[model samples]
Target: MLKPQRPLKLLIIDDSPDFQLLIKTYLEDFGIVCLFATDVVQATSTAVREQPNLILLDIGLPGGGGLLLLERLRANLRTAKVPVIVITAQTTDGLESKARFQGAEEFLHKPVEKDVLIDTLRRVLSRPPTQQA
Candidate 1:
């Protein structure tokens, strides 16, 4: 008999260690396996290697930032359709619009409500390809 597969794998790219810890703790019980990257380079590498089902990206990353990473990921066929949720504090001056235009599935502001985050992830992951956000 085969073992049960996990529901989802999630990658979080953020510079704040405390925030990372908080998210990890908040999401672990929901059956999401969380992976962390403090910078764009590591995030990109992890995204390719881990092939997470979803990505929570922070806009203010070091070296390249989340938008740059989103561009790179969209250009790569292997990771292009993976649902990305932009979780950032910088939701100013069309930043959210830019993220949406860059192909992020959803843009979530920081200090994210736990229920909203989980619900958004669940909805995105549950949809079929044509319906995915």
Candidate 2:
């Protein structure tokens, strides 16, 4: 008999407890298992250890910022190819471009719209991992 598949795992790297709870609720509605990391150190360690299917990263995180963490994630072979969707409250010019340049599969604004978030997650998960140069 074929083995049962595991639930999809999504690592959420953000410093806000309220946002975490909110996002978790949204993702749980779709049957996704959520993991949390509130800082860059924890984020890297958890990501390396858990090997989540996807990552939702917040750009304003304390301890090193999300852009730096994104670079580190891309540099590490274990986490490099895991799709990242950057979620940020910041509206700074070029922030989205920067995240995209760093390998984020999608960029989302804060006060995340439930439908859009879910749709983006599904779309990103459905595609094959792009071969990194």
Candidate 3:
């Protein structure tokens, strides 16, 4: 017999309320435990306090940006190993590489579909902790 899989905890760091709700609703059916933070402060606090299994971070934000948040997250010992999947509407040149270099485990453009989101989440989580970055 196999042990049941635990519900995956996810933190979504996006300033848009609509986007947050969309992601939560889309992922709820899969039994993932989703949390939200609308800005840099909230994101940072939540990342440390909640210690989510994965984070879906958006690039554009108020009071600093996702890159800054990512850097801070990486620096924090509490949440440093958490796998981060970068999400953004701003698909500027070299953004993906920049994110990866900053320790993002994966990158996904905004308006992501359910299947892609699920697949990416599983892929990131399945990787060993050392390989998450």
Global lDDT scores for all candidate models: 0.85, 0.89, 0.89
Error of 2 at 120 (Å): 0.4
Q: Where does model 1 exceed 4 Å of error?
A: 1-5
TM-score for candidate 1, please give it. Answer: 0.91
- Which ten contiguous residues of candidate 1 have the minimum total lDDT? 1-10
Residue-level lDDT for 113 in candidate 3: 92
Instruction: State the TM-score for model 3.
Output: 0.94
Tens digits of lDDT, candidate 2, 33-132? 8999999999999999999998999999888999999999999999989999999999999999999999999999998998898888878887876632
After superposition, which runs of candidate 2 have C-alpha atoms over 4 Å from their true positions? 1-4, 131-133
lDDT of 3 by residue, 30-55 (tens): 78888999999999999999999889
What's model 1's lDDT at 18? Answer: 94
Q: Order of all candidates by TM-score, from best down to worst?
A: 3, 2, 1
Residues 1-133 of candidate 1 have per-residue lDDT tens digits of: 1112755788999999999998888787777788999998899889999988889999999988889999998888778888899999985799988998998989898899888887887677777986543
Q: 1 in model 2: Cα distance from truth in Å?
A: 24
Model 1 whole-model lDDT (C-alpha atoms): 0.85
Name model 3 segments beyond 4 Å from true. Answer: 1-4
